[model samples]
Target: MVTQRSSRVRLEWGPIGADRIVEPDCLAVVVDVLSFTTALTVAVQVGAEVYPYAWDRQDLGTYAAARDAHHAVGRYEAQRSDSLTSVSLSPRSLAVSSGLKRLVLPSPNGSTISFRLRDSGATVVGVSLRNRAAVAAWLDAALEDDPARVLALVAAGERWDDGSLRPAVEDLWGCGALLAGLRDRGADVLREASPEAHVALAAYDAVADDLEAGLVACDSGQELVRAGFRDDVVDAAQLDVSAVVPVLSGERFVDARRPLGE
Candidate 1:
């Protein structure tokens, strides 16, 4: 009889904690709902190339200077992004230049968190609602080599002054839900395990009429609104939207066609 393989699914919430647990051989899924991840989905679909860099502005500047042309994409309140092109920019702009040699991306949380995990031994893949099903399928196939434990890190925003996390509920819900779905291969497992799936499901249930409200209430959902990327939010939130897995290959992220035919 063929032996059955049993894999334990580990669920992690915060960026730091998730980063600490990542191993080189494992698969790393980084989620930053409040825009970065959402924007990434849009950029890729729009045919824009994405180069992720560590949040060090000096390094980013150096990278950009080497490139031909680029644009910055990010939130304003961040620090050290004034000189770069940014969106939702304030104190420092989160920058992503188009066609630039370097993409100086600095999010309050996503970039640093990505760097930490990327530094680890594990294989890193960028996942958001848009590519959730693709990620799951990739994990299933990668596990064939027993590459390593697969880890999903939700780059949820920081905590509130009360020490309670703002946006915690949605991301935590999403991550846990993802774990639940991955653990089982059944069709229902897909919907059962995803927090992103649940949020959308609930919204559909409550306001089958007002999709905008349901997405806005979620932190990551709201970030998409602020960035004027509603189409991306709805698209990413779909299950199995793409048959291919979007992975980090050297500098830019590429869509690796599906490993197995569905």
Candidate 2:
């Protein structure tokens, strides 16, 4: 329990960290700022249900067809699509995609984390820079109803060349953004935060003012920008612009404030 960072809010990196932090009474918040969770946020905000796919399979098209959902392609593929319906892991690709009812977004970090946590007996939530404040507010109300619940904030950092966790700074900033919002609600939660969680919050506060510039300067951000998808990085840098909170229901995600099937 001590290694678990026994606080109302805990912080860790990647899917392995997710496995360690999640509990039946925990809200497992997945933060993947580069694209996955950002895309999920935009999709859910526009009333689309997102299904996380491992994205490492060759049968991606068949997989999407089986689920009756459109499979998101790569960002470069999305950009060349004849229509905006060509969804991808990029949040910018989801712009003007309101008619899309369902999307199978695949990612190595965020999607994998979500997939691993689906059966962990913890409530899973999708978090990004786009909806951090909304999620934090939503959490405040949800936790109020269940006093025993804690927050397991997982930053789905990128992987290194050796397939080890890269611990991307943007993901840490994203988690810190949520933590900053959560801690603002009261002194108790702020005090209950683990030192690691506090580190994340401090990370966010340090560069919240120039987040866009900060993102553009980061390794992951530069990768996307150099690929001619700078728009994706720019779109993701916007903070707390979305009010929609995506909660994983079954295998897909839906808006938390909206009743299921509504």
* Prediction 2 TM-score vs. true: 0.94
The candidate maximizing lDDT is 2
262, model 2: CA deviation in Å? 1.3
**Which stretches of candidate 1 lie above 4 Å from their native place?**
1-7, 55-59, 67-71, 75-104, 159-167, 180-184, 187-213, 219-239, 258-262
Off by over 4 Å in 2: 79-84
- In order, the Cα lDDT scores of the candidates are 0.49, 0.86
lDDT of 1 at 130: 51
Instruction: Please provide TM-scores, in order, for all candidate models, with all chains considered together.
Output: 0.64, 0.94
Q: Tell me the lDDT of model 2 at 25.
A: 59
